[model samples]
Target chain A: MIKAFIALVRRDLLLAFRHRAEWFNPLLFFGMIVTLFPLGVSPEASVLRVMAPGVIWIAVLLAGLFSLDSMFRSDFDDGALEQMVLSPYPLPLLVLAKVLAHWLVSGLPMLLMAPLLALLMTMPQDGIAMLEWTLLVGTPLLSLTGSIGVALTVGLRRGGVLLTLIVLPLYIPVLIFSTNAVSAAVAGLPMGGQLDFLLALLVLALTLAPFATAQALRISLS
Target chain B: MWNAIWVFFHKWASPRYFYRLSGAVIPWLWALTLLLLLGGLYLGLFVAPPDYQQGQSYRIIFVHVPSAWMSLFIYTFMAVLSGIYLIWNIKLADVMVRSSAMLGASFTFLALATGSLWGKPMWGAWWVWDARLTSELILLFLYLGYLALVNAIEDTRTAARAGGVLILVGVVNIPIIHYSVEWWNTLHQGATVTKLDKPSIHVSMLIPLLLMAGAFQLYYFSLVLMRARVELLEREWRSEWVREMMGRGSDG
Candidate 1:
């Protein structure tokens, strides 16, 4: 089972790299939205500083959203997902492996790019580390929960908008906590409680979401 | 006695039996809901004395609080029904979820609207990130997500099963969402509870709040039954009992 998990993750990563454009899409989208914020809202540092946490959190979420619609699309289209479902090893483990690969390619890039966005927003220097740490914990939870959404919608041809409506609500708690963590740092308050909440949520999602994604994948594909 | 109860439930599982059973039961539910709502609104609006703090405007609680309660109640209820459907693959449980989602979303929306309306007079803003209000708004999005999943699929059974999985996932997040929202709300503003709680209001106000909550529940039961019957007819349209019903012939 562990071998199968690695093979699935390796295959996903290789595929993600082979089509290098896909890797850059979420990154470029993240950069563009960060750029757009100043145009839409304001260019002043104090104004951006006040709005930095919310602005960066929302951009990361939208970039993740942009990438997730295609999470299961290629696998489902190529019939690889159906083969995975029929395999003898446990399906949930395989699903978890795929989610891990997705996070590495999609969420990690967003997390890496977020610092540049934070710089653009002129967030206080002290708050940057906390913001990065919050995203590190929060993004995988998005990937885990987002997989359940993708698995449910994988079979439909016109699933993009509907996918957003289904998945974005599930991201709210993560957004609220992660953004608050950064805001606390900005306000010079103790950030432990908010980070602890984010970690707790990540643990909950990590334990529960794979099984659900596996079940949803089976039901949708069947 | 246990055997008889078991046999009774076995019969109740049949769509034909349920259609008739709901028809027989809903009138009583409707009558009860109407009485409670009418009585509750009258007492809540006129007889209940003003709050020392907010005075007359607090009466919106009659509509606001009950709808907010129903919002959470219906989602948890949907999770229970979703569980039953997932385990037993029962057709009726799925039918219940199909009808319940829209009603739940509307209640969530009403809660937000009323909560905001109440906030403007009290909090000096059109909206505040109060824990209850924020969580209720997210609850609305969750309902919308479930509805979107159910409607997006072409097959009824597939939609029901997929939406069921989403409900289970949503249920796991709800408490965490509520807790996080509360924590976030407190981090920004000082510690304060929203008006949904009753410490400030007297028993005269409390009675109507409880009554309205019960009335909202009864109204949900009747509405869900009515919608369930429509979904049953749609799904089972080509089956034997439905054919007989459509032919104006007695099945028994």
Candidate 2:
């Protein structure tokens, strides 16, 4: 069972790697969104700095949401999901593997590229550490929870926009805590407190979301 | 003992049984709800003593507090029903979930609207991102999302199961919303009635508040039972009881 799960994970990774442009698409979208903020608003460095955390976080969240639509779309179309459900392996473990792969492909790239966007926003040097920490702890939760949304909406005809409506409200708390954590660090207040809350949220999502996603898949498949 | 309770719960999973039972009880439930609401309002509005602080405006609590309590209570009730639906493959439980979502969402909206009305006088702002208020707003979204999800799917079973899973997952937010005022730096005031220590308000005020709360509970039961009856008929149109109901309606 473990071997099959790993194999499924590797298969998804390789498939994602083969379409590398799709992987880069979200990063580009993230960057584009961040860039548009300056054009839409004043380009003053101080103004950009003030809005940086929120802009970057919102952009990353949108980018994550964009990529999440495809989390189960391909497997669902090709009967891969059905086969896995029939497989000897547990459905929840299979879902965990898929979410792990989704986090790697969609969420990790956003985290990796966040610093460059932070530079574009003229984020203070001291704030970057907390920014990175927040993204590291927070984005995976977004990916995991977002995948459940993706799974629920996977088989629907007009799912993409509805998916956003369903998922974004749920994402508000994570966004609030993460942005607050970074802002607190920028202010030189104790960062530990908000970071601890973020970690707790992450742990909570990790524990419960996969089961929810697996159940969603069952509903979609049925 | 546990198994017997499980068996009892499982027995009512049938849509036909639930449909007939809810149909039979809805009129009585509606009558009860109407009586209680009228009595509660009279006691709450005319009879209940005004608070020393806010005076007449404090009467908003009679509506706001009960709706807020109903909001949380209905979500928990929906979640429990969804759990039963998932575990027992109960069609009636699914209907209850669907009906409850609508009732819960309305109560959430009522809570927020009444909260805003109350807040304008007290807090001097129409709206604030107070923990309790914000969490309640999020609860509205959760209820909306659940309804939208079930509607989006074409298949009834799929919709029910999908909405069920979402409801269970979203259950995390309930407690967070409940405790947000305590756990975070929020603008909302802390607990008023459910404090562990001595009661916060005078007995006169507390009595109306409790009465209003009971009225809201009855209101929810009345509506849920009514909606459940409609859902039962819609889902079980071909069943014999439904045909009998249709024939009886025509005869009447």
Candidate 3:
């Protein structure tokens, strides 16, 4: 079982690397959004500083979303997802492995790029570490939860938008908690509370999301 | 008792029998709903004294509160029904889900609209990022998402299955959404004093409030049953029971 899971992850990682555009697209998209916010809101440092935590988090969210809509597409198109569903290994285990790979490709890059985006946005130095840490805890959640949305809609021809409408609401807790943690860290307040909540949400998503995503994948195929 | 309950579930699990049963039951439900709504309205509007704080404006609670309850109730019902459909392949459950989605959306919209109307006089704005209000709005989005997913797919069984999983996922997130909204609201601002003082519910107000809640429940049953019958016919158009139903209607 572990071998199959590892093989799936390794295969997904290889596929993701071969398609380098998938690698660059979300990073560029994240940078563009952070740049746009300064223009759309204000160019002043103080304003950007205050807005930085929220701005960065929202951009990270949208960036993850931009990539999540395609999470299952290639495999779904080439019939890999169907084969995974039929494999002797449980579908949920396969789904968790794919989600881990998705995070490694789509979610982790956003984490690495956050400091640069935060610097570009003129976010305070104190909040940068917290911002990266929150993204670290939160982005895997994005992939896990986002995979559920992708699975449900992958069967549809134009499911991308509907996928956003459905999945965005579910992302609310992660957004609220992570943003709060960053802001709290900047303010030198006790952030353990907010971080704990984010941890709880991540745990919940890790436990429940894979099974739901697996079930949704099977249903979409059927 | 468990045997009796199982027997009841088994009977209704059959879509044809459910269609016939709902047809027979809806009119009676409508009559009961009408009676309850009228009674609740009379008690709420005329009999109950004005609220000490918000005055007569508090009357919207009769509608707003019940609609909110109905929204939650219907969503929960839809999630459970969808789970049954996914697991047991119950066609009756899918029809119930299809019938209930729009009704759930309507109830959610009513709750939001009435909430905003209540907010205007109470909060001095049409909408506040109030915790309850935010959660209700998210619930509305969840309903819209479910409806859109189901309708997007061309195949009925696939639509039901896909929508079913989405619903189950949404249900799991609902409590988390509600709690996050509460904490987020408080984290940003101090709790605002709202006019709806739930604990001090005067006996007079409580009577109508519960009655209205009951009325809304009946209305949901009545509405969903009517819609489910039509859904059954549309889905089962080639089936003999529907043809028999149509022929009986023609003969009558």
DockQ of each: 0.85, 0.61, 0.91
Across B74-155, the per-residue lDDT of candidate 3 in tens digits comes to 9999999988888888789999999999999999999999989988888889988878888899999999999988889999
Best by TM-score: 3
> In model 2, which runs have C-alpha deviations exceeding 4 angstroms?
B1-13, B177-184, B248-252
Model 2 alpha-carbon miss at residue A117, Å: 1.3
Ranking by TM-score: 3, 2, 1
Give candidate 3 regions above 4 Å deviation.
Answer: B1-8, B186-198
Q: Per-residue lDDT of A32-75 in model 2, one digit per residue for the tens?
A: 99999999998999898888888999998999999999889989
**Model 3, residue pairs in steric clash:** none
Cα lDDT, all candidates:
0.88, 0.85, 0.89
Check candidate 1 and list the clashing pairs.
none
Q: What is candidate 1's lDDT per residue for A2-67, written digit by digit as tens?
A: 899999999999999999887789889888888888899889888889889998898888889888
- After best superposition, candidate 3 residue B210: deviation in angstroms? 1.4
What would the TM-score be for candidate 2 when compared with the true structure? 0.94
lDDT of 2 by residue, B1-252 (tens): 999987776666566566667778878877887877788788888888877889899899889999999998999999998998898777878888898898899999999999999999899999987888878888888899988899999899889988888888788766754454335557776678999898787787787788778878987897888888788778889988778878999999
- Which candidate number has the best DockQ? 3
